[model samples]
Target chain A: MRASIVQTSVAVVATLLLFYPVLQIVLLSLNKLPYFRLGGEFIPTLESFQWVLQQPEFWRGLLNSLVVSLTTVGILLALSLPGAYAFSRYKFKGKDALLSFYVVFTQVSGGLGIAGLIALFAIVSALGLRNNLFALALIYAAGAIPYHTWLLKTYIDTIPKSAEEAALIDGAGVNTLMLRVVLPLMAPALAVSSILSFIGAWGELILANLFLSGENRTLILWIYSLMSNVYSVQWNRFAAAALLYSIPPVVLYVVLQRFLKRGLAFVY
Target chain B: MRPQWLILPGLLLFLFFNIWPIIYSIYISFTNANIKNFPPPPPWAPEELKQARPPPDFVGFANYASILTGPASSGFLGAVFWTLIFVALSVPAKVALGTFVGLLMSSDRVVGKPIMRALLIVPWALPLIISVVAWRYVFDPTYGVVNQLLYAVGISKPPDWFVNKDYAYAAMVVIEAWLAYPFIMTVVMGALANVPRAAYEAAYIDGAGRWAVFTRITLPLIKRPLIYASVMTAAASLQFFLVAFLWNFIQLYDRFMLAYGYYWAFGSPFREYGLAAAVLTMSALLISVFMILAIRLAGLMRGMYES
Candidate 1:
């Protein structure tokens, strides 16, 4: 009983320590302190939220994030499903090598080699695709494919080959087998990958900052820019904006928590 | 094999955007191609030659030489040192804390295990930028809740958290540890659940204390997962740009300047592209060496791979 009490106490302390900042932000956002002073008495006010809502940039940035995230997810699914099926079902040469490549590729830093990517972007711009959202989506999709394919392949592997074989025996075409037999079974994996891809594209700062400059800034970049200068560092407003920015990813994760767990189980 | 064609689209995309950039970055690291020096003037114009070209001249080894011996070298070295400190401190703390929580969650003594696990993941699931920003607020010396709480408890004043380098590094370490521990904890918890209980029972029957049982059985069982998590965390921490960049951008935007800043000022930020590439490539190489050493030390990979 004593040990249990100690464990409970420790867990409580750790959890509180971990979340103190978030709690503080929530409090500050709710309480409208007259001054920016840290320890001043505060009264509740909706001024921060009011300010946040009035900013057109906030809504536009959020929309851009949504568009990029959703488009990236859609493209990831369209590419990963058929690709994962082919890799899982076919005993091709260099299969192990290809698998290893994808795994290692994801493990490597996506942002590490941005300069080369910027150079390539220059080349693409020369081809007249500069500052295009579709181009950004394609870039995100390309970066996401390795991990998503690996995830889907792992999920597909768990479904017995006999299921697909039986479908084939019933005169199902390859596309039909993939569409009818494998895809449905892979829904959990698809959901998880989609969520991961969405969150990744949504929260991504460096790539977007690099590629999507000027009017094309994502929500994260916009929020980051708000705090870029001391003159613009309005704590209340930043906190409110942060709360708004954090909502979508939080909602998505909550909705897809189960699928994420399953997907994580497969990957790890 | 018609289905094989489906692989081509994804593979081609990956090759173009993913693999090609990596290769291009590696190649550029060996050159002196700075974006600032692009569109060089006619070669015959000696007067134009005197003007600092925006695109970097093909000065082989000059960039690398500068990186090692230039005035900015110490700062780069400092950044590397601090990064190492951050990783070394945070990774072990995370592993230890995570394991303790994992053990507690796995044990029957703990109540509300699901809630505990879920709470642990909240930090991990919170978007990193938001979490970091939240941490900045909490550590805000003027109006931060930390200072407020401390002052309420009779402490007269708290130190400037992000201003002083030591405190700044400490704050970063704390935030990073929080961000990372959940991942390690979840992985360790999964491994702990797979640990056979009969061994612990037998140890208890043999008059073993809790510490002895944990040290002898639990630690050894979860060794592989722990090593994997440690190495991955180490690698991730070494290349940590976001937190540092954000923190510096927030606190010392004017004061802090590096090679990247110089490039940005000149309007051809790609001047330091080669150096940036080299930095990451070296980091990857270092991580690979560490991973191989870890795998050899753990000895699990041998069994799995040999089969």
Candidate 2:
């Protein structure tokens, strides 16, 4: 009983510490004032939400973000499905070498950092691809390939190859075998990869900041811009926009939570 | 009919977008590619301006020299030192705190586990920008709850978080730890589930204490996942950028390697892309060396190849 009390106390404290910032932002978004203060006015209003909802740029940025994120999911699945299929099923030359390279490089890819940004900036501008949303999606998709391919490949390795062998023996081509036999069996893994890719592309800012401009700005960029001026920041409105912007990813993440450990275990 | 051909599409995209950029970045690191000459404006630009800012010249090792032994060396070196310190301080904090919470939550003694878990996972699930912005408010110094609580406790004039360097650094560490612990905790919880219940029963039957059981039995079982998380988290710490950049880029840019490289590229008036590339190249090399050492030490790659 004593241990239970101590455990409960610790759990409560930890949960509060983790939830405090999120709670503050939620309250700030509903506060009447444009800025936040600990003991200031307590009048509640939806003015910030109204203001944010009324902006044309808000809608445009939302559309742009959706387009980029969905396109990323599409391209990512297109690339990773085949790539992981090849990896899981074949014993091609350099198979182990390539897989090792993927795992090692992805681990330290953060090291490469934004070193490539300069060249990317140069190349995009020179090719008239600046401010192009699709081009931006291509970049996000490309960066995710190494990790997601490995993730799905690990997942594919779990399934028995008997069904695929039967399909192959029945005269089904590779495409039919994959789409009919493998893809359905791997729906959970596909959902995990797709949602992860969507969230990544959705919240991404650095490359988007460089490659995009007015009207092509993503939802994250628009919310970030709200806080840019700093001196005249509308904390309430920014909070509202941020909360609304965060909804899709948060929902998708929660839905994906059950599958997260299994997917992550393979990668991390 | 070849199965290998299936890899072509991803390989092509990866090469064009990923491999090509690194190669291009390396090539430009050896050239003087700055705002004046690197990215020529769209074709609609003025003819004279285009002619004025000609193509980048091959500066050879000048950019590398400036970063290594030239006037800019101090900033680069300082950023590297602070990044290492940040990683050292935060990774352990995140892991230890996460492991503690994971053990607590996994205990049968803890009630309302479902609700607690749903609440705890919010930090990890929400988009990062929201959390960072929210943290900005919490540590606002003047109107924030942190200072308010400090004042209530009879302390006066807590240091402004973003204004003071040390305080800002501390705040960054706190936020990074908070953001990352959820991931570590989840990983720990997963690992814990795999631990045999019989081992714990045996330990208790033999008159083992809580600490003894944890130190001897639990630690060994969970050590592999913990090591993996630490190394990955450490790599992430080395690449810290967005939070610092968002919090106070001007003051904190010199405190992180990537942010420092960012300053050279976009923050500086000269737009020294070549210098920025060199800085990033060195950072990449450093990170790779660190990762290889950690992986070899931890035997992390053994599991990957086997799986």
- What TM-score does chain A of each model score against the native chain A? 0.90, 0.93
After superposing all C-alphas onto the true structure, candidate 2 shows an RMSD in angstroms of 2.5
Any runs in candidate 2 off by more than 4 Å, and if so which? A1-3, A35-41, A261-268, B40-52, B303-307
DockQ (C-alpha based) per candidate is 0.43, 0.63
Tens digit of lDDT per residue, candidate 2, span A5-114? 87888998988887889988998899998766767776799998998899998999999999999999999999988989889988888888888878887876655637
Please report, as a residue range, the 10-residue window in candidate 2 chain A with the lowest summed lDDT.
A259-268
Model 1: per-residue Cα lDDT over A124-202, one tens digit each = 5445555667788888898889888878887787788888889989999977987888878877787788888898888
Q: Which TM-score values does chain B get in all models?
A: 0.77, 0.93
User: For candidate 2 chain B, which ten residues in a row score worst on lDDT?
Assistant: B298-307
The whole-model lDDT of each prediction reads: 0.68, 0.85
